[model samples]
Target: MSDSEKKALSGLTLDQLVEFATESGLPAFRGKQLHSWIYAKYARTFDEMTDLSLEVRELLKSKATIQLLKLAHLEVSRDGTRKYLFELPDGKFVESVLMSFDDRPSLSACVSSQVGCAVGCTFCATGFLGFKRNLSPQEIVDQVMSVQRESGQRISNIVYMGQGEPLLNVDNVVHSIRTLMASVGIGARHITVSTSGIIAGIRALSREGLQITLALSLHAPDDATRDVIVPINKKFSVAELIDATHEYYEATGRRITVEYVLLAGVTDSPEQARELAELVRNLHCNVNLIPYNPTRAEDGVVTYARPSLDAQHRFRKIAESTGKTVTIRLERGTDINAACGQLHNSYVAGP
Candidate 1:
């Protein structure tokens, strides 16, 4: 079999790895060692598994392969945020971001679920690139592994907020989440999955019993405004999406996160902020306000500007007046086009 045809060992669970090992005529302990090396030690190549005998290594190498994403390009912002562009085995590209904070010792990684996005959120650069294939569980998990190896820091938080709408690839995403928790040792609470209000996917995720945080990218409060920016909102609507979030909270008991992007004139008005506050007043959630990050203006793409600091503060104050927990997201990696809604794979021409 070709290398591509070989089993990818990086995404397998402990039991599955043991099955692979025992099926290959090796002892099950070898599978446990493989799990530790691939998920914990972040091994990239089979030869790095030095604990295995040479014969066993060669046999495993011939039968299975460790498929880690190849780092294509990297950018470091002044704020110590690092953005990585990875080239997949098929030559497609995906982006991952590692963010470090002055107050916290642990790092956070934002990983992509698809090569490009289909949601087509007007403010998101990734959506403008159009849709590509969904990334496998291996591809998704490997992003965290690669970032951890490159930064040499423990990634305590993982966000599925890069490149694509995570719920679009819910199966692979859930698989990767389990792999991250079981093999990589990241807890469910530290991992967050953001969606542009995919209602069915939200319902499915709530039934999974995983206590990971769910963030709805409800960029606008009303259906009319949401339909214009987040096209998916047309199908799901603002009220329906809010209802799904409430159902999710009831099932998971984990408070939801409502992600709102403050576009200069479009979404930052005081009235809209008040409307947003009232919209979610009864929901068990906190609001996260993201300042728009400007993308390169192509001919057909609509241009948007970030809200001024004063405008942002006014919106926050209005939302806070209703006794809602609201916070303006601290911007990161804007200098390198690596901030929120800025992962467009600009390193290459287009998707």
Candidate 2:
């Protein structure tokens, strides 16, 4: 099929695929077969649907195409974390990280939801690039399928913690989550959608009635520090964000995760930790402490220092003292530039 003529079959829901099949003069069951092949079996082409007859396969080949992401580059770190640069059809690039665990052989895929990012957090690499475009549901789901196929391992956890603010593209993200849960068979609890404090998105997701986890990137405790680091805080203050988080818990009954990125001398002070403890004291939530990832200094771009071990522990101690569950996230994939806040595909392209 010609590139311009063929339709993308990857984004279609099962019911839509059924409509496609029925419209093609085939039995409705062919939709289930096609869905199973594309999502469950990870078929890259129409020919891979061996259960379908040659006639149906040829018909599909003429009208539809199952397109996977074109792998532009793959970086594997010494710590066994892998970063993938996938070239979209429009020549834009997005990155995803595959993290491997030692205790269990499970793998987690951190997928991107946008080309760059509109949330211009001073220290984030993607934020430096600015927003490009929101990925379609197919683009989002393809990240997981690409990681699983390339890594030769099943992804047990899916984190929407990559390039862009997930809630900014809430509809596509939620659609991809449904596909991941219903079609791909990953449990709802295993999927997490992380947003940089989009109150409407959080409230919208809470109404979806799925058991998926909601992680809010609460990088600072007070509005002043947060406004500097997380610019979204300027619009929605810490108190308003917390109120929305509480509403999410009340509606969904799922414990929210408050993610804090520790930056040296900026947000890691003992006093800030106390403020953070007070900020989240009333919310039913867990705190995930992430160390700031360094990036090359560029003009007009803000750089931050990674917190020292003592500072990290001290902050964790203070946050934990508030009787809320808190844990420090072990940094991974930094060597490969795939750790938290390090994904910038513009620099990875060949000269």
Candidate 3:
């Protein structure tokens, strides 16, 4: 079988790895060694598994593959944020970001769940590239592994806020999350999944009982405004999405993160801020205001501008008046087009 057709061992659980070992005529203890090498040590090639016997390594190589993504380009921002453009086995591209915080010592990796997005959020650049396909659970986990291997820094947090709408591929996403927790040793609380208000996906995630944080991409407070920017809102509606978040909170006992993009004149107005405040007044949530990152204008796409510093502060003041936790997101990797709403695979195809 071709390498692509071979079972990808990266996404399998520990027990499954053990099963693979025993089924291959190797002892069960070999699987425990495989787990430590593949995940804990971030081994990318069979050759890296030096502890395994040469014969066993060669045998395993014929039946399974470890690495899935090839690093096509790496752009490092002045502020230490690294943007990785990875070419999949099929030649499609996806981007991941490694961000470092000044206030904390932890590093966060932002990963993609799909090659491109189908949600078609007008304000997001990923939607303009159009949809390709859902990334497998192995591909999803490989992103974090690639970032961790490249940076040589332990990723303390993982966020599904890059390239595509995560909940659209809920099954693979959840599967990858379980592997991340079980194999990689990253706690569920450190992992976050962001969605463009897919209510059914939200309900489905809540039922999983994982303690991971759920971030709702509610860029606008009302349905009318949300319909224009986040098209998913048209189907789910603002009220229904909010209700879904409440359901998620009730089920998981975790505070939801409401992600609002601060578009210059479109979504950053003072009135909208007040409306946003009233919108989530009762829900147990925190607000993350992302000032828009400029995307290259296209023929038919709306040109969105970042809110001025004064405008961003004004909106923050109004939202904070409601006494709910509110903070502006720290902008990172904007110079390299790696910031929020700026990931569109432009490196592969020119804008």
Candidate 4:
């Protein structure tokens, strides 16, 4: 196997890294330097680590890389939101978003786990790219580091809702989460993962008992409509999704986040809103209404044609009328394709 195919250094736990270094005839304490380089220094290359002995660095260089991802394209929106198209070594591409909101005692960064999405939510542009492969834990962590490198602002909270569906890539997703919780020094409670309701993944997460949040993209109220908007609903119905979410809450004692994206005439209707409110009332959850970001369908026709300012207000009322607490997630990054499903990296083009 090539160095890239060899052991992924970024995924190694601190103890595992120390073990690897010791087994290679280097002192175990050398592992601290590696972590410092990988996390603290964010070294781009093994050779850039100035503290390691020349011989030791050469021995390490013969085996692994100090890198994971590089920026392919970065577009800064007029509103200061930055979208990054990062190209992995294998040539597959994924996107990450950096949203700068007013300080609220903490900061946040949203990262992706796969190149394109297999989930194909009717509203997301990442689905347009389709699934390529799962990002290694290293690849996943690199995204956060890249944002830190570019913006110089340390991220306080992490959200896995940028590109591909996360839970589908469970092992790497879990590893990334653990790395964030254990090695990256972020509290598990501060991380949130959004998914398209993959039951198996939810069951697995429940068993692991992670405190990380799970946000379900519940675009429609009923199975018939949900099957059209979120295709995965055909396999895991609304009832199953709710049950899985309850399982998560039972295991972790944390409330799940229900993400409802409002399309112009579909999910934004007051009736749909009422159904959604009632549906979640039976579960342990909160509804986050996302106004659909404008983008073309795979067929090259525009979907989500107009913004739903009026529908938004009505939907909130319907939820509140049902005594459900509701919050509208404000849209950001439109000027630079920072909106959801708009980061058409291919269209981002040779820059």
Candidate 3 lDDT by residue in tens digits, 1-351: 788777667656789889999998999999898889878887888899999889999999999887678788888999999998888889888999999989999999999999878999887678877889999988999899888777777898999999889999999999999999988889999999999999989999999999999999899998889999988776899999899999999999999999999998899998999999999999999999999877777523467888889999999999988899999999898788775435444675564
Give the per-residue lDDT digits (tens) of candidate 2, residues 1-351. Answer: 576567777756788889988998889999999888877777887887888889889999888877657788788989899998888878788999999877767788999999888889898878877899999998998888888767767888999999899999999999999988877778988988999999999989989998988998999998889999899888889899999999989988889999999999999999999999998998999999998877766523587899999999999999988899999997787777765445453345321
Worst 10 residues of 2 by lDDT: 342-351
- In candidate 2, the residue pairs with backbone N, CA or C atoms under 3 Å apart (3 or more residues apart, or in different chains) clash, namely none
TM-score of every model versus the real structure: 0.94, 0.94, 0.94, 0.90
Determine the backbone clash count of candidate 1. 0
For candidate 2, what is the TM-score?
0.94
TM-score, candidate number 1: 0.94
Model 4 worst lDDT window (10 residues): 342-351
- Structural RMSD, model 1: 2.0
Kindly report which residue stretches of model 4 are placed more than 4 angstroms away from their true locations once superposed.
1-11, 45-50, 54-64, 103-105, 297-302, 347-351
Per-residue alpha-carbon lDDT of candidate 4 for residues 25-95, written as tens digits (9 for 90 to 100): 88888887887677666566778888877888888888776656667778887867788877787877777
Kindly provide the TM-score of model 3 when superposed on the true structure, using C-alpha atoms.
0.94
Tens digit per residue, CA lDDT, model 1, 20-51: 99999999999899999987887877889888
Between candidates 2 and 3, the one scoring higher on lDDT is 3
Give the poorly placed runs of model 1, Cα more than 4 Å off. 1-6, 340-344
Question: What is the lDDT for 202 in model 1?
Answer: 98
